[model samples]
Target: MIRQYDLVERVKSYYPAVDESLLNRAYVYAMKMHGSQKRASGDPYFSHPLEVAGILTDLKLDPATIVTALLHDTIEDTEATHEEIARLFGEEIAQLVDGVTKLTRLELTNEDSKQAENFRKLILAVAKDVRVLLVKLADRLHNMRTLEHIRKPESRRRIAQETMDLYAPLAGRMGMQGFRDQLEDLAFAELNPEARDAVKSRLDLKQEKSRDLVVRIADEIKRRLAAVGIEAWVSGRTKTAYSIWKKMERKSIALEQLSDIYGFRVVVDSVDDCYRALGILHGAWPMVPGRFKDYISTPKGNNYRSIHTTVVGPERERVEMQIRTLEMHEVDEFGVAAHWFYKDYVENGSKKSVSASDELVAPFRWLREVVEMLEHDATSEEFLEHTKLEMFQDQVFCFTPKGRLIALPRGATPIDFAYAVHTDIGDRCVGAMVNGRHMALRSELQNGDEVEIMATGQQVPPLSWDDIVVTGKARAAIRAHRRRAEREQYVRLGRGIVEASLRTEGLPVDEAALEVVVHDLPASTLESLFEQVGRATLNVETVVRAMLVHFTPEKKSRRPKIKGAKVAAGSERAREDGTLPRGRPDAIPITGAGVGTSVTLSPVSLPIPGDRIVGIMQPGKGVEVYRIDSPALAAYDDDLDCWIAVKWDIDADEHRQFPARIALVLANAPGVLGEVATVAGKHGANIENLTTTDRKPDVYEMTVDIGVESAQHLERLLTGLRGLKSVSSAKRVYG
Candidate 1:
């Protein structure tokens, strides 16, 4: 085990002001808290925190952050508490430790969800205090480095994938090139061992063969810079496994297609020297066409500044070169951590605002746009997935109509852009113009293409818009608009039920008649009433009765005084004649047996406009219509008409399906489904469904459907398919 003194010495570079007493106390406390706990590597668990602290120390973070790293895992994994940590250390250190502790304890539904939520929290924490993320990134960096100690392949893959998918991307976002490269390379090794080995072997062979050439070129560049009176440091860099994988994917070429795999960097004293050195390097070697990028003028989203160029060397071999200042190099290596030293001095000891890394911080205006996307009443999953597509996915830069730049993820369209502008515009979008040419809503945006959204004031969003819009914000806004529209529909439906009942009771309701009553109830009250009804609180019929009674109170029986009209005593004729359809009425024909007209026993089974219908006729009463398969009529044993006859509309396509088991058998040959496509083209059948299982030893089972117009057509196809080489069998599964 490493001693506390050695760890303290390692951390001293960042914290010369930190005394030995603080270090000793933290070490003892961490050890006490983690007593006898061992990692899967079988070493003491203290090694993990020591390594984490060392990583933070290398970043040259504050002493408190370093100490917090030492104790970060204590509270979560052991008996240590936040109050205890605060009591032992100062509040700042305790807060950081608690933040990390909370991060450690978070339970995600799955690794990806957990990681995304963690990243969200981590970024928020970083926004509050940048050091929180620094410690976390360092901690993740060390964990990734030591991932081999994990036993399960799945666990290793999960951690590696998370590192590759999230942490490495985050490191790139933070401008930590060195850490990002290493994490990606490490992840690649685990996730794709074969490709990793192949790239490694090829690069190693190339490096061995070109060792002398690299040295000579580096030396020449160093000498050229020295001659120009520009002090510089130059070194060669070998591309890592993940970088080669990315190159292979991007260029659609194998390892042999890659040249200039060996790159060199020239770090100088000043920004001017960086540019001067770039010019000198160009002069030394013939520049490759369109292979130069001056990031110094336009830094990357992560605040990385460099002038990168590839050149054909003396041996006619391509070599990539990067030129940057030493400060830029440090910032490239340490990312946001490097800002601490200079920013502290510049800010005069006060903590700098989140904007301190303005040059380094990725534009979060996109996040604000995402928040707006979520402003729509989108479900959590839809909102989260869409935001993930924008925030967590890779970014593509496009131009707005005015030539201003707008960055979105790959495959984002103008609809996403319109929504990003505002919800109303997105909801009303009718069309779009890409570079001033009208295109479909699904037209993918290309890099640097000027996109103009064409919206209309008269148009409402289509239901299909939910499927087409890609951005989370836009999808959410569209969904929200639809949801509010749906709620309004429900409100109208509910109001209609109440008003129609009032009219039948001789208290007719219209906009003019009900407007006063409606004005008495606010939207909040209406919402509450709906909620109560939805929750099965206040009965709908009772509510209707109360409203009618309130609007038109019951008056005492009286005789009307008309000119020369005979006066009569209190007449019960209208009330007792039963002309109204209150309970069960007479004279109206009931369709089925034992059913009444105008009398619905249960409101739970009320027939609406959209409902399928059935009728039941009663002896003195009239026909009582009932919904098919209503739970309210389930107990009626003798009354068959109470069951009602109903059928769904033949043209209605509004069927919703739960999960169903589908079995598929793919052809047992190489490239068979590509084979099936060739075979399917022979037949006039279109594949409506396809699903496959994981690969087994030989034959793969996949469920596929070839749509047929009729049962005879399906049978004809099946009969012909009995022994057609790849078609072993075909069957339909009802489930």
Candidate 2:
């Protein structure tokens, strides 16, 4: 264990005016609180926090961070309380300790939810004070270092997977490459021990065979740069086993085929020297095409800056090199910690303000967005989904019309860009322009493209928009809108059913009576009761029957039956041949069709304005519309009392098109798809989408979505498709 005096001296080495007395007090408190506790490694439990503090010292973090690292586990494992820590240390340290404690105490039912819920709390906590995250990362790093001592293999694997999925990516996003690399390697060792060991053995053999290769390369780079009068420090090393294995797997190549496994870094005194050093290195070797990137000019969202290039150098070997200024080097290695090195610390026992400056806080914009998302009405599973989408994708930086930069995932669409701008914009977006040219709303955004969103005043978003967007914000917003719309639709249908049912019973539904009935039920409001009825949770007949029993106990009434238009069996139905249909005064019109609707010949064998449609009233659920012979109608035969009569509106426009789905089994041969397309076109059918799958060596199955004028038109198209020699089967798929 590190001595208290030695720890204080280490802090003073970087922060000479750090609060030494406070540090001493915290050290003693942690040691005393954790008395008699032993780690899985059989060492004093105090040694864990001590080692965590030692790790943060290497990052040169603020004194408060170092202190919090010492006490992060106290409230969770020891008898210490947050209030006591506050009284002794201060509120800042107490708050940080509370945050870490909450993270530690998360108990979830399964691993997936556990990981997501833990990250949810982590984001919320870190949004207030970034130092809390820094301290927790250090804590996780130390725990991983001692993970081998844990007895159970399953427990170790779970911890390693979580570290790889959560902590490592977070550290990388924060620009802490050193921490990210170490965490990944440690986790990889447990998750894939054989693969890791094999890669390590290969690396060890390479290192032994080329004992002086790294030194020779570093010396040669130094000698060349010195000749150019550019003072620089050049260092080289082999990539980590995890990174090497990942590269090989990603490229589908053997280890020997990898050329950039050996890498070098050149740190200089000034930004000018960084470019100058790059020029000298390139001048001395042949540059590799498509392998150069200038992150210095266009830094990553994490604020990482460097110039990377691959070149054939020193013995004609392909090598990777990164050049940056000394300041950039420090910031790249230590990330946010380097920023605190120059800040003034609190003195005289006064507390420092927790708020950070805009520049210092800018890199955490994604974190703030996540916090905002938590406020939305999303379930734990949904929260996890969006957060994972936000965390685990490479970014493409684009510009708004006004030159504002918006960073998004590589495959994000314009809808995602709109959501990134603001939620309102995304909800109302109708179209977009990319780089001043109108493009499809689902078009993938490219780096540096200027996006312009065209939004309308409409409040409801399209349900299909969910499939077009890739970002979490856009998907979440679309889902929220759809949920609200579905609720309203259900409520409307439920109200109509209840009102009609009451009229049949010769009773009036008044607000007072409705309120009384709602109060007697499980619902909190009249609207909620109606919503329940619409959702089929509460049977409309039951509510009406209950209402009659309460409002008119002396009168016995018969249940209302749905009246249907009487038609002779096998009578000529409304045909889609553009002929006028015989009018029935008793027919009820379907919603969306105006009065005096006429049944038209449907172009496809699909639901058309003139189909034999009926409405099925569910108990609490409103009504579901289905064709008379449809497969869905078979599901509700047990509840025949809920069935209602419905018909096509005669006033529906004849020019409107309806979609139809068709399945075709065809002989596997060239020109078969073309022949099907030709047949569809000849019948005036528009193919909207088509998917082909191989069912056998010589046969294929195809599903096609086509738009047609009427059911007759669709029948003609299906007949035409069946006439083709390549097509073995053709039929309309009914829902």
Candidate 3:
């Protein structure tokens, strides 16, 4: 346990004029309130908050923040009241405590909706005062440190998973690298103990073999800088076990193959000295190609700035070096916690409240962007899904035509760029010009490329756009628009159905009768009632019964059907070509919708626009489109109500790409894969994915997924592949 005097002294060490009395009072209050309350670990609950405060003290936060950390859980777990805290301390301290209390009460569970709703609250509360997040992070870190003491394995794993998903990434986004690393390592230990232990053992054995390697490297770096008349400090850094494990998973490499594991950091006086040190080091040793990045000129989204390079240095070892100024070093190590200045200044004889500066907001741009997604109407699960998407991606920085920088995920497309700029632009995006040349909307954006989005009111976003866009904001915007479009269609369709039923009964669509129906049902408005009726949640007969004077069960009503070909999908009546006929008034005409997380094309069958397809409505998921004759459709055959008739709405002149798959057997020879890529490129198709399996020692069997204009385009590409000397056989794969 941290003593009250020790806690105050620690704060006073950084802030000479901190309010020691306020902190002391809070410490005593929290301690007494948690009297006999115990944690799952059988320890006094007071110890948790005290340790959380101790953690913040290490971060060098303000006195009020420290006090808030002490009392964060009191309002939720104890008899303490916000009003009492406000009376004892000040309103600012009370409000800070309240904010953190709200976050603590949020029990983020395994359920995505509960977790996402809690995360939403966390973001909104932290956006008001980042200190709340700081307190919450410290609290979580302490809990994680003591996680093993809890008896329930499920509870322990749940907490660990939550830490990895939310707190760890949240810390990184706020520029707290140290906290992020610690949280990740702790969570990684719980989630994958064997993997973590394996990485640690490898590191330990390597350390045993080379006891002085890091020290030798650090000393050599310092000597090199000293020779150049640049006074500097050099320190060694080794990747954490979790970090190494993540790299191994990402690159599919083992610990023995990792070269950049041992590294050094060179910190100098100024930014100019940083470059000078870099030049001297690179000139002294052979620099590794394609391993250099200059983040000083263009900082990361979190405002992390450094110059990273890997080189063949001392003893011909593959060593990594990070060069930065002293200020950058402090900012990199401590992040936003290095600068927590809160003071009450008197202006015009009145106290003006001042917390963190707007400058702090710059590093947290990612947080604000996620919160902005709420306005786009994302569901709870979508909020969680998109937030993870926003958090876990390496960034590629690009520019607008007017020279404004836009930092996006590495594989982001112009659709993502447009959404990042503004949702209106994304919703209306029609085409793009990358670096002043017209590029496909699905083209992966490169760093430093200047993108010019060409949007028009005359164009609606194609369904295939969903496949290319990577950002959460972009996908959420697209889905929101699709929902609105679907709702409008349902409204119109429902109105027609009601009008037809009124004619059958010889009644008119009068306001009096409709209003009665609306009031008697679960709906609050005519559009709401119609939307329900159209979605089939409420039957047409149910609506008609509300207005009938003597409604009886003898008169039955059925769902209105659109007039068209009544032939069931996947039935023997389909065309001989196995393709549905083009123009149908009844069948819902649709273009190729991209694969979805909630609802998508069946994995067993990848259908192009020319294939006979049907839609299956999943309960929680939106709609799953599938090839009619696929074996996977057998599962849904008994339940015809779930089936929806649909047809491709492709125009003959439109050259949009649809997803298709092909299987290939190739002679195992040099340059065979290269030849396959060349053929794919020449046929105007993008090879989205390629997986290879070994048939025998001399043969390679692979599946290739390509985007093409239609089935004909795939046939032409197959013809080109069959002509290759390396390809033994090629055939379209449907499943």
**Which segments of model 1 are wrong by more than 4 Å?**
1-3, 9-21, 108-127, 224-231, 269-290, 340-360, 363-380, 391-396, 399-403, 419-441, 451-482, 498-525, 528-735
TM-score of every candidate relative to the true structure: 0.66, 0.82, 0.76
RMSD of each: 13.8, 6.7, 8.9
lDDT of 2 by residue, 1-735 (tens): 888888998999998879898899999999999999999999999999999999999988778878998998899998899999999999989998998888777643346766677677778777887777888789889999999999998888888888888889888877788999999999999999999999999999988998998899889999999998988899899999999999899899999888888999999888898889889989999999988888787777677889999999997878899999988898789877666543554779875553342454435766777777776666666777887777678778889988888888889999999999999999888899999999998899988899999999975677788888888888878887766766776666556656656655566667677776776777898777777876767776677766766776334333322234322121233122211122111223455422111122223224655556655555444555555556554555455455554565443455556677889999988999999999998988899998875578899897898887667788899999999999899998853
Clashes of each: 11, 25, 2
Better of 1 and 3 by lDDT: 3
N/CA/C clash count, model 2: 25
lDDT of each: 0.64, 0.77, 0.80
TM-score of 2: 0.82
Q: What tens digits encode model 1's per-residue C-alpha lDDT throughout 251-321?
A: 89988888878788888888888878878778888999988877776565556778989999757878898
Which residue runs does candidate 2 get wrong by more than 4 Å?
107-110, 340-360, 428-445, 450-468, 502-517, 525-527, 542-607, 617-623, 629-635, 640-735
Q: lDDT per residue, candidate 3, 606-716, as tens digits?
A: 878766677665643434677766678767645555555556777767777877889999998889999999999999999999888567778889998888987788899
lDDT of 3 at 658: 72
What's the CA RMSD of model 3 in angstroms? 8.9
Q: TM-score: which is higher, 1 or 2?
A: 2
